[model samples]
Target: MSTIKRDKGLDNTLKVMKEGYLYTTNQRNRLGADNIFETRGLGGKRVLVLSGKKAAETFYDNDKIERKGTLPKRVVNTLFGKGAIHTTTGKKHIDRKALFMSLMTEGNLKHLRELTRNHWYMNTHRMEQMDQINIYRESIILLTKVGTKWAGVQAPEEKIEEIATDMDIMIDSFRGLGTAFKGYRSSVKARRRVEDWLEDQIIQTRKGKIFPPEGTALYEFAHWEDYLGNPMDSRLCAIDLMNTFRPLIAINRFVSFGLLAMHEFPVSREKINNEDDYAYMFSQEVRRFYPFVPFLPAKAKTDFHFDGHKVDKDTMLLLDIYGTMHREDVFENPNEFRPERFLDWDGSPFDLIPQGGGDYYTNHRCAGEWMTVIIMEETMKYFAGRITYDVPEQDLRVDLNSIPGYVKSGFVIENVKENLDRR
Candidate 1:
């Protein structure tokens, strides 16, 4: 049996927070392990950090690993919400995941695409009248409208804006601590407000006071029965509904990253406009190349041997998402930004996992990942093909030390013009 190398620290929680996306990758490099290593996480709890394709396969295997009770209380409270499908296991997970997957059908995703493009047209017109705009902040507002409308979530414009801002806070605030404690507190408050509104919507839907369409996320979740065949709790239903809207809005981060990629690589921008398949390639690369999800949390379901190392029941594990995608073994010249790499790439779920690695239906892989790709591809087409804008001088660097990092200057653009002929 090969011994797993361990980090020499009492607790590396602070280091994980400070190092952000690179924490486990750096540890794996230092330990000279390709797939597995041991480290102490919060309060010195033994954590097995796993990386690479083989490690992801082991981490996602349901017979070996499970998600229930693995996430910290803080993450549950703010990011995923209590009783989210992300926290379920076994049959409960499949039942809950079914509700999410139903919304990702061919017809449904096509509607989402149209909605995104329509919103982009509005945004482009709005941008034409302004001198300069930051794509990150602007996209938060734009995607918020697209997400709510597509989910059949009806609310006053003001209420939509409020909830959207709160959702943004929830994602941004999840990684902060110590001097950044206020952001975390704000996330709690923001989540509470969003859930309160959603719970009310669920109640109203059930009572027939409001009517969301049959195929919509809000309607389905409000009426969804549990694995035992009881009506889902309104709170749980609300969380499930949020599991739809939140990730849709979260796609704005990838949009920002995509714009950064286009700016950094002008050839990518050109290819997106001229080459029919390049938009898809560029979107895939954006997901693979950037930092979105830092890691995934799970635990051993029972005692098992992984890669000749013994993993006991209830042992905590952290899967290194960012590191695996960038490994030299996974992709040639892994650090370089090139969309062409994906052109010849085999569609291995484990290799390019910005969303996650595994089968979408049977694993914990994100349900909205397909939708994320479509929206990004459309956004790439819109920015590269339908509009002309000038990149002003500013900080384009995305700081890797931050969780879910974005371009520092928010990818600022000026002198925007709409290309009506292209439209």
Candidate 2:
């Protein structure tokens, strides 16, 4: 973590000053990097302002800047680092993001939209007419179908399950909650079955002309150039790109996290409407509200001072993303779900993130963030405009809780209008 200077324009400036004091001085105990820090938590003299954009910018810039080791072992190894997109920062990062945008051009988005419609027809429906609709549950398959179809990916639907199973196995490698430990082993076994299915798709895609010259994600990724040169490292980049749809499809989990925040923190709705960067603000809430990844572990490239304490190279720093969201100094009503704090009086999106902030595609932040936001806005509108589901009665009141409840609790589909009409 880099030393943060309080900046202009945030609602909770004073709280940050107090917390920073506690964190830097020894008045508070050391917050070993792994521990989850509440969004506005004030310990010691240093205040850990999880959502402090300025501090976040400093921390993101400190040391190597775009270290891509925050993901779980499998994903970090398979999809991060130099070959992956998020390792980029600065101007070059903008170029890469632009390239990604080009691929999602008018024609491409058109194709994707068509594909999404087809997918909705094929995969999603009311589980039972009487049973409540769980967009969270349906989101997995819908996102998977849309991703694969839009990317022109040559894989069967079952392979998506393999990816999910793999995620489970990886999650289990660390301590999981209760029965999840058992689920992890089962996931490992399930992955073997997935291998056979994924192999066929891989072979088929390689043999087929699925990657045409125009309008395909494969074409764009396969021909991209960077440090490796014009044709870039096609095989590696493609393999990385092939996994792109998985994250995109699985984006519903992120959407769920955001919506849950909206429902839990009604006060946040005011903030969201006030900003120019509705997309950015919503993106930030996603990063803030959800546990996208449980841990962000990284090997220190060299010795560096974090809040004045020296850490040696190869030391692992655990950046608890969820913890960062709740730090009191960075946000007002840190635990409350308020989106307006991020926006101006006008209703556009502003500073929010799911992927890391500052610069994208070339390094630290996510490449797909723009597209992700588009999808989220559409989904959010669809939900807010169409459905009126039952809010569950629980220990926490829906009126004031940070999160209303699980997707299953009082999760319902009612008062649905045109958007919710599958048929």
Candidate 3:
């Protein structure tokens, strides 16, 4: 039996926050290991950190690892909500996941894309007359509008910004625990406010005081029953509904990253607009090249051996999401901003898992991944062809230390003009 190399510390929780996306990757390189390593984290708990394609394969093995009781209370309260599908396991998880998957059908995704196009058109027109636009801020507002409407949740135009702000606050809380004290508190409050509002909407739907369309997310979740054929708790149903739209708003990060990519790699824009396949390739590269989800946490279901190391029952495992995507063995010249790399790439879920790996319905992989792809592809095509804008020089560097990092200057653009050559 081989012993995994361990980080030198009593508890490296603070270092994890300091290093952020590079924490485990740094350890992997320092220890001269491809994937598996041991590190002590918060409260001196031993955590097995793993990365790369094979590591993802092992981390997502449902029989060996489970999500039950793995998520921290703070993360649940601020991000995923108490009863959201992210916190479920076994039969309950499958039943809830199926509800989310039902919304990912081709017809549904097409509708989402149409929404993206219309919203982008109108928003870009509005942006044209402005002095300058912040892609990050504007994307939040626009995507919130799209997300709410798509979910069958009614939000007045004036309230769109408010809802977007709250969602952004919740996501910003991803750096909670050690340093982001203010963000963590704001996230808890923001999540509470949103969840309360959603619960009321669910109540209104049930009482016939309000009606979302038959196939809309609000209608589906409000009416969904559990495995025993019982209606979900109104709060839980609301959480599920929030799950539907919140992730859509979260795509703002990628939108900003995509714009930055366009500015940095200008030639790719022409390819993105002119070639159908290149748009997808560019989006895939954007997901791989940037930081979104830092890592994912799960617990060992039972004692198991992985990569010649023993993992005991109920041990915590951290999957290095950002590191795996940039692994040298997986992606050649992992640091370069290259969309062409994905052109010859084999379609492996584990290799390019910005959202997550494995079967969406069966595993903990994000159900909104289809929505993410559609939105990014549409946004890339739109920005590449439908609009002309000037990227003013600013701090475009992404701070890797932030849990959910973003372009520092928010990808500022000026002199926006709409292209008459419509697609």
lDDT of each: 0.86, 0.47, 0.89
Tens-digit lDDT track for model 1 on 258-347? 998888888887888899789999999899889898998898999998777999999999888999888998888889988889788889
lDDT for 325 (candidate 2) = 50
**174-264: candidate 2 lDDT, tens digit per residue:** 3322112454545445434433443444444455644444456655665566543655443445544644554565466666666666677
Best by TM-score: 3
Error of 3 at 53 (Å): 0.8
Residue 124 in candidate 3, Cα distance off native in Å: 2.1
Ranking by lDDT: 3, 1, 2
Q: What's the lDDT for candidate 2?
A: 0.47
Lowest summed-lDDT stretch of 10 residues in model 2? Answer: 396-405
TM-score against native, each model: 0.96, 0.63, 0.97
In model 2, where do residues sit more than 4 Å from their true spots? 1-55, 62-130, 155-213, 223-238, 258-287, 345-353, 388-423
- Model 1: CA > 4 A from native: 177-180
Per-residue CA lDDT of model 3 for 46-161, tens digit only, reads: 89898889889988888998988878788888988987889989988998899998887777789999999889988877998889899999999999999999999988999889
Q: How many backbone clashes does candidate 3 have?
A: 0
